[model samples]
Target: MTASLTPLPLQGHVLFRSSDLDEARARVAEVFCPHRLDTSGGGAFAARHHHLAGQGLSLNYIEYGARTRIMPGELGAFYLLQIPLAGGASIRNGAQGYLSTPDRAAILNPHLPTVMEWEEGTRQILVQISRAAMQAHLAAHLGGPSDRPLTFDGPLDLTAGPGAALRRLVLWLVAEADAGQSPVAAPAAGLMAGQIEKTVLSGLLDAAAHDHMAALGRRRAAPRPRHLRLAESYIEAHLDQPITLEDVAEAAGISPRGLQLAFRQHRGTTPLGFWREVRLARAHADLLTAAPGVTVTQVALRWGFTHFGRFSELYRARYGLSPRDTLRAAQGG
Candidate 1:
C-alpha cells in the first residue's frame, strides 16, 4: 500500500505570532516535545514560529527569549538538528556539550536526555527527523541492514561543503513550501516529495559524523556499473527539477565525490557536466519547437537555466546558433 503523508502547505505556515509565556512554551512544546522551560530573561516571552512538515521530516523557525535554561525531555523517537540564525545556545546532550550558532548546528541525539540554554533574542531554525525513518533510509542506501545506532559527535560546522548545502536545503524547502512550489505542498509533486525527503536524509547521513560515517564516506571503493547507470538515469529524468549532485548521488546510493569519480571514469565528464549536457540538449529541442507565444528565455528557464547570458552562450556554442534565433525560426518570424 502506498502510504499517504500529510502535505506541507506549499506556501508554509505564515509567521505564527504569540507573546505569552505559558502559551509560547506550551505551543513550542506541542510542536516539538513537552519539557521544563524556565526563563530568567524574565521579561515577556514573545516568539514567532514558521513551520513546514512532510512525511517523517519537519523544519521550523522559532525565536523566543530565555536567560536561564530549558530541559526538553528525551526524544526517544526523533532526532533534531538545532541551528541558530542570530544569537546562539549552550546545549548539553547526555555527556556531550556544545555551543551552537548560525555557523554551527547541534545534532540532538535521539534516546538521550537533553538540556539547552538559548541567549536572549536567539532566532533559530530546527530540523527534526524520525530516527527510525533516517536509520532505515540510511541502511537502504548502504545496501544493507544497520546493526548499530547512528550517533553524532557534536555541533556541525555549516560554513562550507555539504554542511552549507544541508543548511541551504532546509531554508530552500521552507521557502518552497511557503510558496506552494515544493513537492510537499504542490499537488503534482507526487513522488518528488519523497525523493526530496530522501535526498535530505542522505545528505545529512553523509555530512554528519556518525558511527556509519566510514561506510557512508568510503570513497576508495568505486561504484558498481548498476550504480553508475542508476545515477545517470536519475539525472536525466530530473533535469528540469531543482536537483543537485548530492541528490543524484543519493539516488544512486553513493557519496557525491564517489559518484563524480565514477562519472569521470565512465563518461569522460563530471556529473555536473553530464547534467548540463542533458539539460542543454532538451532546451535545444524545446527552442526548436517553441510556438509563437513561447520565448527563448522561457525555454531556458524551464530547463533549469538561471543565467540567461550563460545559457545563451552554451546554447550557441552547442547548437551553432543562438536559442533566440532557433525560437524565431520555429515561430516563422
Candidate 2:
C-alpha cells in the first residue's frame, strides 16, 4: 500500500528538478555534504529539491523518485533532521539503525556516519542546522563549554509530546514560506529569520534525547539561589552600559567562578546569558513605546547591542516577534 503524502512543500522555491543522477548528486552536495548516491534498484531516477535558506539553518524538501542508497559518512559540520512525509527510509547512523516513517523521524548528529536507503516514492522535509550554532547554543544553556560533542538519539517519535510539537512547528514554517510571509525571505526579516532558526534548533534539542539531557534536567530543577537575584538586578540596572562577568560577580558578592557556577545551577544559564536576556527585554520595551523618529537600529545601539542583526535576532527570540514589528504596532501602523 502506498503511503499518503501532503502537498509538496516549497513548491514555488524549487532549487532543482532533474532526471540525471550525477547532476542531482552534485547539486544536492553543494547544499549538504558530498555523498554517494546510487539508484541501482531498477527504478527510474528522477529527483526534486526545494529549499529555503535562513541565517543559520535551512529548510528543504527532497525526493528521488527511484529507490536510492545514500552514504554520506560523517556529516562533519551540521546536523540533519529528516521527517518523512510519505513512504519511508531505512537509516543507519553510527551504531544505531531504524526504519524511519511518517510517524517516526530521524535526526543525524554531525559526528555520526550515516547510510540511508530511501524507498521509491518517499518524500521528506529536512531541517539542516550548523554544528557551530548548535554548540554555541548548548554552551549558553549549559553555562560553559561541553566536554563532549552534542549528540542526539537517532529515532524521534512524531506522534506525541515534544516530537509532535516539533513536527508541527516545521510544517508551520513551511506554510509561512509558501505564503511569502516567512522570516527567511527578505534581508529586512533577517532578525526574525534568526529567531525562527533558533526556535527550530532549540525545538530539536528539546524534542530529541541528547547527551546533555540529565544535566539540563538538573539545572531546571535547581533552586534559584539568592545571589542570582542580586546579579539580575545589577544586570538590569546596567542595561545601558557595558559590563562583564567579574563586574556581575562583584555586584553579587561572589567570586567569578562561583558566580558562574551559581548562575548555571540556579538560572540554567551563564551570567552573560542572563544579562543578554535583560538587555533584550529592555530593547523590547523601548521598541514598544518608541518616539516616532526612533528606529530599530537606534534602539538596539542604545542597549549596548552594536550588531544590529544579532540584536534583532536576540530580541525576536526573547519577545516572540521582531523589533520592527513591535515598533510598528506601537506606532499603530
Candidate 3:
C-alpha cells in the first residue's frame, strides 16, 4: 500500500515500501509533488517505487521499474539533488544532457524545465531542498557568475567516496524514520538532511568549475604552443620563485597583457593568482608530510614564500588557519 506523510513546514522524514504502483504514485504526488508543474514533449518517465524521506529538507527516493521519458517543464517548487542508487537516468536542459551513473548524481534546477528518461529496474534518491534552505547554506559562496539551467555541473562518479557515503546515510535515515525505530529519529534525520544538502552544493561547485574549464578550452583562438608551454613550465619550475605576472609573462615570451588574457581564458585564473594558490597548497602538503621539527617557516620558505607576514595571511585566508597553528594541530603538539 502507498502511504502519504505530509511533511512539516521546515522538516519531515518518512519511508515507504510498497508493490502497489497506483498507491506509490498517489503518495509521491501528494507529499513531495512539484507546485507549478507543467510538461511538454509528452512522454512518461518511469514507474517509481522505493523508500524515501527527509527532515528540514525535502528528500525523496524511488526505485524505477520501467522505461519512459519525462516531459520538460519547470518543477516550480524546489531544487532537486537526484542520486541514482541503482540503474541510471538521463537528463537534458536544452543545451547539454548527461546520464546519471549509479552512485553518481545530478542537480536539477526546479525553476527551469528539464527532461528526464529512465530504464526499467532503476532506483534513485531525490532530495528537494527549498530556496530558503539553499540561501541559508550558500550565503557567502553564491557570488561571481550565475551558472545554472544550462547543464549538470556536478560529480559524474559516485564510488565509495564522500558522495557514496552520503547516499547511504540518507537512505538509512529515511528508512529509520519511516519505521519509527527511535522516537528521536525525526530530529536526527533533520540534522543529517542539512549535511546532505551541503554535500550536494559542494559537488555542484566542482562540476561548474569543470564546465568552465571545458568551455574555455573550446574558445582558444590559436594554439600558441610556445606561450602556453612557457607559462606552464615557469609556474612548475619556479613555483618557489617569487612568481609574478611580469615574471611569468617574460618567461613566456609574451606581453604581460597577452599572458593575463591567456591564463584567464584557458586556466580560469591569471598567472600570479594561480601560482600563489599552488605555493600555498604545496606549503600545506609539506606541513602534513614534513619530518619532525619542521617549522611552518621552513615549509613556507621551501614553497617560495619569503614574507612570513604575507604568506601567513594568505594561508590563513585560503585554509582558515595560520601555518604554525596548522602544524601544531597536525602534530597534536
> Evaluated with TM-score, which candidate comes out highest?
2
- Candidate 1 per-residue C-alpha lDDT over 300-332 given as tens digits, one digit per residue, 9 for 90 to 100: 889999999999887654444578877887889
Error of 1 at 210 (Å): 1.2
Any runs in candidate 2 off by more than 4 Å, and if so which?
Answer: 1-7, 223-333
User: Which structure among the candidates has the greatest lDDT?
Assistant: 2
> Which residue pairs collide, candidate 3?
11-56, 12-54, 12-55, 64-122, 73-113
lDDT of 2 by residue, 1-333 (tens): 233444578887899999999999999998998999998677789899998887667889999999999999988768889999888999998998999999999999777799999999889999888765786677566544454568898799999999999999999999998887887754557667777778888888899988788777775676457777788788888887889999999999889999988776655568888777657756776887898989988988888999888887765544435788889988888
Residue 194 in model 2: shift from native, Å? 2.1
Report the Cα lDDT for residue 20, model 2. Answer: 95
Candidate 1 off by > 4 Å: 1-16, 186-189, 218-333
Q: Report the alpha-carbon TM-score of model 1 versus the true structure.
A: 0.60
C-alpha RMSD of each candidate structure in angstroms: 18.3, 9.2, 14.6
* Candidate 2 structure, TM-score to reference: 0.68
The per-residue C-alpha lDDT of model 1 at residue 114 equals 91
lDDT of 3 by residue, 1-333 (tens): 012222311122334444554555565666555222222233443344343334435556565355645553655445566776566778765454788866567667554467777655556667665533343333224211112222345545556655556666555545554665522233555455556557655544444323354533333444545796688788879988776788889989999999987766555556777677667767876785767788988898888888899998876555445788778867877
lDDT of 3: 0.57
Ranking by lDDT: 2, 1, 3
Question: Whose TM-score is higher: candidate 2's or candidate 3's?
Answer: 2
Is 1 or 3 the stronger prediction by lDDT? Answer: 1
